[model samples]
Structure formats: C-alpha cells, structure tokens
Target: WSLGLKGERRDLAPVSTSYYRVQAPVSTYHHRVQAPVSTYHYRVQAPVSTSYYRVQAPVSTYHYRVQAPVSTYHYRVQAPVSTYHYRVQAPVSTYHYRVQAPVSTYHYRVQAPVSTYHNRVQAPLSTYHYRVQAPLSTYHYRVQAPLSTYHYRVQAPVSTYHYRVQAPVSTYHYRVQGPVSTYHYRVQGPVSTYHYRVQGPVSTYHYRVQGPVSTYHRVQAPVSTYHRVQGPVSTYHRVQGPVSTYHRVQGPVSTYHRVQGPVSTYHRVQGPVSTYHRVQGPVSTYHRVQGPVSTYHRVQGPVSTYHRVQGPVSTYHRVQGPVSTYHRVQVPVSTYHRVQGPVSTYHRVQALVSTYHRVQAPVSTYHRVQAPVSTYHRVQAPVSTYHRVQAPVSTYHRVQAPVSTYHRVQAPVSTYHRVKLRVDK
Candidate 1:
C-alpha cells in the first residue's frame, strides 16, 4: 500500500489454509493477498459485481498456481486498459466482460515452466474467443485439449453476435514489437485481440512500421495512401515502415508500424479523418459523413446493425462486446453553428484549426468584424461542430455575432457584440 491511497477497503479472514479468497473494492489501487496455504498447490476464489472505472497496474506480475472460479455481474470496464505485464497461472471463468477504449503498450506472456497445468482466461463477451497456441517466444501461448470448441460469440453490453476460430497447435510468436497508435481497438486475442475502428478523417505524418512476417495483405483508399510490406499478405489494411522477411501466416495483418514475429498484430492506427490508420468498420447503420471517411487500414467484422452515431463525430473510441450495448457509449457531440458576416481577404490565416481550435493572424494589420455578417465567406471549424470560435478572427461589418459562430475579421480585433477577438500570430 502506498502512503496516499484513497477508497474503502475491507478484509475477510477465514481460518482455512486449503484455499484463499479476496474481494477488492472499486476505485482502489492497493490489494493485500491472503496468506498462502502451501507452496505445492494454490487455489483462489473471487466474486466481482460492479463497474470498474479504471482498474490497471503499471506492472502486474502473478507467479502462482490456481484453480480459480469467478462470479461476475454487470462487469464493464469503460476506459483504456494498459496491462504492462500480466503473468498468471489459473483458469479464469467469466461472463459479460467488456473493455471500451484503446489499449496501448501491451505485452502478454503465459507459460507453464514446470509442467504447470491450465492457465486460461474466459469471458462471455471476450467469450473465450481465442485458443492462442504458441510456445517459447514473447507471446507464446499453447492450449492442448481434446475437442476445445472455441465458440466465438462476441457480445457487447447490448445484443448477441458470434464467430469461430480453428487452428493447429505449436508455433511460438516471438519478438513482436511496434510503435502502436490505436483507437477503438476491439476484441483482440481473447477479448485482448485489438483492431481499431475509427470514425471521421485521419491524417498521419512521419509514420513507420518494421517487422519480419510470414504473410501480409494490404488495402488502400484514394488520396495518396502509402504502404511498405516485407512479406505476402492475405488480409492487410494500412502498413508502413519495414520488417525483415519470412514465410506464411493464416491470421489477419491489418495496420501496424513495427512488428517482428510470425504473427504480428500491433499497429499505429488512425480513424476517418484518420491517417496512419485503420478504419471504423461501418456496419449496417447510416452514419451520414458529409466527407470521405479517411482510414489507412480497416476491416469491418460482424459489428451491430442498430449502432447510430450523429452530428460532427469527434474522437469517439467505442469498444463493443457482442449482444452487450453495455459499451455502446453514445458520446454526445456539441454543435457549432456557421459564422455569419463578410469575408476577409486577409492573407495567411496560419493555423485556423489545431487539436483544439486555433485561428492565428496578424491582429495589428488585420481589421476584425462581426455580424451583420458577410454574404459569402463562411468558415466551418476544421475539427468538429463544437469548435465555434466566438473570437473575432474574421467577420463582415458590425452586427450581433451568433453565440456559436466563427467570423474571420481583419482589423484591430476591437471586439464588439461581446465577442472575443483572438489575434494569434
């Protein structure tokens, strides 16, 4: 426990050394382990029923042997999960587990060093979707079981959807490395398999990828998309940089900057209006994007049909489990109206929009104005509908400016009409 840890904590002590149990409180960072029963055999039981806001650890190392039975209800993680190192030896039984955000900087390794048996993680939404079989390398997973029917059923907090996976065993995925830029990465290796789904435009600069691969597949959209692959591809979206070379793979290689393994899945991705990107697998709904949805790489798997997104879509990294709209996070987009007034023939409107909204100009030489706006020269905020700069960047003659309007004015940004005049150089 650290010096300053907040939240409520409870301890339940039992007089048994055969098995230990722990119940953790939400919004907490510290957890005390129940005393070990024996060095030979270990067993754990936990009951979880709550909303986990941010349950993460910088380095979570578990070196033990256990047969764990978990009871869960309404289990939802509505944020980013960055598990730097999670090492466990147990059977995780679960139901309706969902993570709704981008997972970055992940390294998952599971091994049975001394004939240690059965280390598994199961979920209803993650839903035991992957039977990862690899040995010896960085992400080396092997599952040896007779008739292991991996029934892939992806369920969000909403409805029920499904898929299936079948593969032969014994291949260790070694040395998987890359600079990963991702958003809305859903359903990776057992709810840990990540592929980005972005909405809107994407732009990438100085992007790179490096890896040695077995097989590769790539697809590109219009407007100058560049890809550099070292191997052959069957399913590839957007890839940059370079890896060494190898042979064949049966998996899907979508978007990534750097990867060095037999099967590589890490990528630097962006969304529509997204560059260095993958894409929002536009499903059965009608999202009226007034422009082309820009993405470097994207493969729309079997997502939902009733998923609806409206207005100027901002950066909404939505994660969904099958049949569970629990994570169908409908983020509300704010509305920014058009600026009404005249047009400013002012030269060099440096950065009219940035990550936020920046309208820069030489306020000294430029004359500013408001509404009674001009007849032409309407400026839409470069980012989203929410970025309505009330500042006097430009406008027509003097009149009341709309509360949510942007007017590019050239003059002494002497602000009238209670509007702010931002003169950024």
Candidate 2:
C-alpha cells in the first residue's frame, strides 16, 4: 500500500467512475477486508496453511472474490482451503484429462480423480510459457460450462484491451473450482462440434470436453488480444476470426481454446463439403452449412490451435497486432490497491492464479481471473503483479456506480492481472 507506482504507466478510461479506498498492491498482496456488503466473508487466518477457498454467489449479484497465497497465513472458515478441495455436490471420481501442470511446486493432472491430496486438476505449461486448462480443466482439456458455453470478446479501449463477460448460467455446478498448478476442466454438454467456432458472447472457452461439442463460431470483429505478447518474431501470422488458422504460434496455440466435449479423432477432412458429425458416436450429420470459416474440427482438426510455433520466444510480440493499431504501451503497468492484512489475518481473493506460473510467469507475472461460463483464462499470467484491483469497503464513492465496477476489487475479477476471467459474460 506504499508504492503508488514507481515508473508505472497506465491508460485506463473509467467512464463516469468514482472510487473510494481500493487497496491492492502490485507486489505482495497481503489483502485485508473488514466487512464487505456481501452476505458472507471468508478469512484465511491459519499461520501455516495453503488451501484454496472458493465461493460462488448468485449471478448478477455483488460478487467480489479474493484468493491469496497459503503459507501459515491465519484464519479458517470451516470451508476446505487446503489439500485442494472441490466445493461441489457431485463427488468426482477419476476425472481424467491429458494435462501437464507444474507451478514451480505443485504439478496437477485431471487425468484422474481428486482422490489424493496432492493431485488436483492441474496442467503443465510447456517450455517457453504455454499451458492450457479445461475451463476448470487444468490443461488442454475442455474447460466448458454445464448447459451453455459462453466466451467473452475482449474490447480494446485506449491501448489497454479489456475482456468482459456477463454470463448467466441457469442451473450449474462448480465441477472443478480450486487453485493448483495447471488447469483443465471440461463443461460437457454435447458431443464434438462439427464446425468449431469460438463465440465470444456465448463464452466458448472450452478446452477438451470429453466428446466433440462446442462450435467455434467466427466472430466478425477481429478481437485483439491485450496480452503484451509482443515478442513473436517468427512466422507470427495474423489469426483473425475463427477462420484463419494459427500457423506458427508453436508456444500454446489456444486456437481451440473452447474445444468443448471429448471430441474423439479430429479427421483431416477437405474443404467445400463438411461432415457435420465428425464424431465416432451417434454419427449425426452436419449440413456443412454456409458458415464463415471452414470447420475447425476438420479443416485443420487434429493439430489445431498452435501452428509451427516452436521456439519463437518473441513470437508473442509480433502477435500483438500492428503496434500502432492500438498504440498500447502502458498496458501491463496498471496500478491497483494492495490491501495488506495484519499477521495471521490473510484475505483470499477468489482470483486464483496468485501463484500462476509461480516463477516463470508469462511476460506478465500475477493476476488470474475466473472465467464464469466455465472457461478459465486466455492471457493467463500478468506482466508483473497486481495492477487493476479494488480496496476494502472503506469509502462510499462507489456511490451510484455498480460497486462491481470500482476497479480490480470491484468488477476486479473481471479486472486483470492477466484477468483470464469472463467476468461480465
């Protein structure tokens, strides 16, 4: 709460916004909250405990989440916060998914059940700094929603782009919600989708939903990624809409970010004609209708997402869209409040990934939002740490503005640190 912003540069435009005491430090977020306006408040006061506390309030309501590091912090809420606890009704058994997660200390794999204490649904980020998680799926698996799969389109204002989602799930469950090393959890609803199109509004941030499910609908508007991925000097092609295939992003081509369902074998079918049900199941047929881009499931099925992107460290750079396009430089330097708690009194922001990539985080270091429609994150880590967070309920300036819009702490979850959250979806 001391360092306001050394040489930090920012370009945020809060329209008709008034804030109060929002404190979230850029480095070391030992947050502390007195009493929020919410119904319940969670505290982590244990001196030496590292458990992931999770809570989901009614949608559209005032939802402020905080997830802090666990190392002898001090307080408990009876809710399981350690040893990886899933706060859901349906007990999971053998939740399998092929993922490689090792966040410096813990390595997760949704390949099995959460039976053991150490093994939670975590995925492994590859060499450079690329990893995927099924919405809840730790890695590579389809991280989907139960009924509806929503994907929020990132809107760029100034140079800093913001991805927001206002998802409204009818009746769902927190299949796999907790903190770990990697990420992979699928939202299985349908079988493998024929034309895999990523719909921003519907939140199709799926990873690997058991069977072929989601359709990557082509978003007419080219949604620019706000990630400072300004380092792809390789064959970093402009991957626009759901049509253009990401050819050389060898790092971790999330082209199929929301590949919901356990789509069996993605056959390499040709063009013009489309085989709707490219599945090994019911054998449903797809008309191969007149859609924007060809079917992602077939056109470039199997080896989808990342193209030939292998060792291009600066590859993400070239991928930042023509620099002048957005002229976004003060992107990652976003300054936010850091709520420092006293000894043995830690505050847990539901914004998991506090330790995302523990050591080798992407260009960004901290910040991880919870994508509502199931999908977890796209940008994943942050440039450094806490940027757009909120302070405790101190002042009342949030006055008329929906408290959720104050800042990080407010719509925060939606706010960044690589806020991979579909907050307003």
Backbone clashes under 3 angstroms, per model: 73, 125
Q: Give the poorly placed runs of model 1, Cα more than 4 Å off.
A: 1-21, 29-119, 123-206, 212-287, 293-425
Q: TM-scores for all candidates?
A: 0.18, 0.18
**Candidate 1, 184-218: lDDT as tens digits:** 12222322232122211121222222221221211
The 10 consecutive residues of candidate 2 with the worst lDDT sum are 316-325
Model 2 TM-score (2 dp)? 0.18
Error of 1 at 12 (Å): 36
- Judged by TM-score, which candidate is best? 1
Cα lDDT tens digits for candidate 2, 1-425: 11115753331321121112222211122223223222111231221122322212111111112222111111222222223322311111221122122111121222222221212212111111112111111122211212222222211110111122111101111222221122112212111211122221221222222322223322222122222111111111111112212111101111112222111112222211111111111111111111111112222221122111111111111111111111112112111111111101112122222221111111222212221111112222222233322211111111221112111232223222433322221
